[model samples]
Target: MLFLKSNKKEKHFFKKNSMSKKSYEEQAEVLSRAIDIAVEAFKKFRPKDFTDVHLAHFVSVYEGYKNDILNPNYKFRTLSALADAKNDILIYFQEGSGPDVNFFWKRIAEEKIGYQRVNKMAKILKRKRIANRMEMDFVTDCLVAYRQEGLISDEESIMLDKMIFDFQKKGK
Candidate 1:
């Protein structure tokens, strides 16, 4: 009778716990899928052109999640982090094609406003080996300031949100 009672209790406990036991492999698979979706969305939805400052914002977001989603023990931020990451990656890739391909930079130069400072900051970003949070934060701050100065457009902001969703779906 005791053996039968103990077996019943064990079965109940097992049933209760079974739903939560996600294997590491399963988690990794999910993360990979999430990244794929994000990458696709970035490729599809990103503007054909963007400014260096916009690209910096997109990169900051991506760097945040590239660390968070891959590690099993890492605390998850809200879905916004993922969006930020995707947008950042998209912008970064777009900017790498040079100034001729990016109209925003040309506009800045034509206007003769904030062009020199932006160029200087871009050089700093390129030269600095951003291996730590401090360097990353500095870049982010500069980018934010550029945005505040009306350098990046509302269309760019919308693209950032799209990239976040793309990353979140992929990271899932």
Candidate 2:
């Protein structure tokens, strides 16, 4: 029991000590330096021969990064931070010699035909005003993803969300 208590105390001490109390400026400088190093390394050593599978994987990971950075609970949630993140993501897409961002989207679309079909079904249900609760939930999820991706305007997302909320609230 004494050994376990000591071990727990040691773990707590390490965990508490590991957290940095750096000012935002200091943190930003560290992040900027890390980004510069990564960019330089990528430029120096990018693979010359990647396959479609690699491209697909890259795009998938890129989308995940985009989603994460745009999430409401993201660490840097300021408007300026979001604008900078958007610019940084755009730079990554535009600077790479690997593949055009549109090509990635086209390939993704080709790969996600089922997603397309579901989206179409949602649209049809929305038009017909007959979407069930489960369908509305799916539409809400899509709206959240679309809003994060900037595929839809904030106002449009809000309007759709309101409509879905109203529909769900009606218990139809």
Candidate 3:
């Protein structure tokens, strides 16, 4: 009697949890279609002043998912991650935006061209022994522009310029 009861419970568990490969593939197809619909709607209905940063990030995530969805050895985690990304994107699109754009969306060009990002790139180039004079010159120009715009401190600008100058002194 106990054996029969356990067998019945096992069958029920399997029935509830079992999903075939075809089922998962079909679900992936549905997710891709949904992403397409959301992309179109977002492009059509978003405000004119709203920049494409969020849209670009969302689309890039989708493109990565799409490219990997058809692999014969694909794992379930990829599908799960895509679904989570989709949910977060939909939440971003749907909530609180009926009133006004967020402060993040109002950021100027100087803010977007972040000081740390440029500094990090320059440091990486120098550390990797790939810091060409032209690239360092470009970095120096960007730092100067950033200083003029108040995006970076004068001291910070001087320090970065000094770093680039030192790198350039070695050779071209």
Candidate 4:
């Protein structure tokens, strides 16, 4: 019958699409892999022993997710990597004692960094904010903050300073 034929076709389509999402066990495996990747990156930073562990964990997780966050269609791998880093960091911070204890609340001075914030900064630059001293100062402060946070090297900071100065002087 025509009805039976349609049902058979529907079942075939369903089976083909059944593997789109992974199982819980598979998700766990992916997350575990992400944690390992994050830890390796963290070790490279060689954070100071007196550095705030919570901040370190947050920074590590941010570093792990940085590239992925820029993607509009964030893949499963990205989600898993972020989740993995957060989980491991949480566990590590929960220890709450030893040399890391007193270092817990202390934080390295740094300005806030976020995806939207970065985009806004770029937009601001594209604007004619260089007409005034305040705007120039704002950009300079941001560059300095970035340097302090190790996001930009001192040389890069100096270069940007000169570039901004040139832009302001040009008055365009």
Candidate 5:
């Protein structure tokens, strides 16, 4: 006859086994709790401050580039330039028409600014025989992918929803 392990050792093994068998939901909850603690600790250590204009510009540029990314026909070079140009315009909008005022205005005007930019890009694609239906389909797919990937937070998700609704309304 073999001697059995002590109750304490058996209890320890059972605890380890039970922990390893946690369901996906239980694992997710544990991971989320850890993340929450980490975030709180980091927030306490290092806070961040951004200007309102910068925040607005960031949101605008992010949304703009995200829209561009959804376009199947969107050229990478064009997207990069558009993003750079938007940044420059934000600088100009904040810095008050510097020495390169004309250049800044040209970029901003060419890019069409805010909501108009989306419509302009869509029209350009449509004129080139990229069907409106296809573009809308691409946008919807991108939105779904973005949500699934957790790229957009709840507030951002609401914004995207509104943007999609607005786009659909305008398309009709």
Candidate 6:
């Protein structure tokens, strides 16, 4: 009993004396930065709608940050940080930011088929789909990606050329 008590006292003494370790402020900063990186990784795909795929992507990115980006000592549920970031991702999903959906719809619109024809198609799809999440993703992505700069000229081709230009280029 005496020996066990001595060992417990020594363990407590070391734990209490180890006050020079990383501070709470530093841990919080690192966690915030890790979450930021995780979100950016998912953004690379430009998924307009949040689906099972986006959730998987977010989980992979979060794990990457937790295991590789953070110190090995940090252990917590990845969902903890994700709970906060999920709202931001949901906004993008609501805005219809996916890759191929919008472009396809706009192509059909720009072609011989007019908006009425497309609305008819949407109605048909609405009857088939309970929630039109995928359909909406397609329409919204097209509007923002194609129509944002200005109206699409009837003379222009319907082909979507996804130019891989860097908007965040260096140098002022």
Which candidate wins on lDDT?
3
Name the regions of candidate 5 deviating beyond 4 angstroms: 1-135
Error of 4 at 31 (Å): 2.2
RMSD of each: 17.0, 14.6, 12.8, 13.1, 20.2, 18.3
Clash count, candidate 5: 0
Worst 10 residues of 4 by lDDT: 108-117
User: For model 6, what is the alpha-carbon lDDT of residue 112?
Assistant: 30
Regarding TM-score, does 2 or 5 come out ahead?
A: 2
Predicted candidate 1 versus true structure: per-residue lDDT over 1-172, tens digit per residue: 7455557779888775554334433444444444443344443445446465665555455545555655534334333444454444344333333333254334434544332222434444344333344434444555555567665566654443454445446543
Q: How much is 79 displaced in model 4, in angstroms? A: 7.2
lDDT of 5 by residue, 89-161 (tens): 3432332222333343444455443211233223423354223665555556555655666655676656556
Candidates by lDDT, descending order: 3, 2, 4, 1, 5, 6
Runs of candidate 2 exceeding 4 Å displacement: 1-118, 121-130
Candidate no. 6 TM-score: 0.23
- TM-score: the better of candidates 1 and 2: 2
Per-residue CA lDDT of model 4 for 69-107, tens digit only, reads 333243543445545544444343332223332232122
Q: In model 1, where is the ten-residue run with the lowest total lDDT?
A: 112-121
- Candidate 1 segments exceeding 4 Å error: 1-11, 14-18, 23-28, 40-45, 74-172
Error (Å) of candidate 4 at residue 43 is: 11
Of candidates 4 and 1, the better by lDDT: 4
What CA RMSD would candidate 5 show? 20.2
Scored by lDDT, model 4 comes in at 0.46
Clashing residue pairs in candidate 3 are: none
Residues 1-172, model 6: lDDT tens digits: 7455557779887776454233433444454553454355355444545687876876676665545424434443233444444334233333433443344334434543222223322342335422344544444455444455444433221212211111113211
What TM-score does prediction 3 earn? 0.35
TM match of model 4 to true structure: 0.27
Pick by TM-score: 3 or 5, better one: 3
Clashes of 4: 0
TM-score per candidate, chains pooled = 0.28, 0.30, 0.35, 0.27, 0.22, 0.23
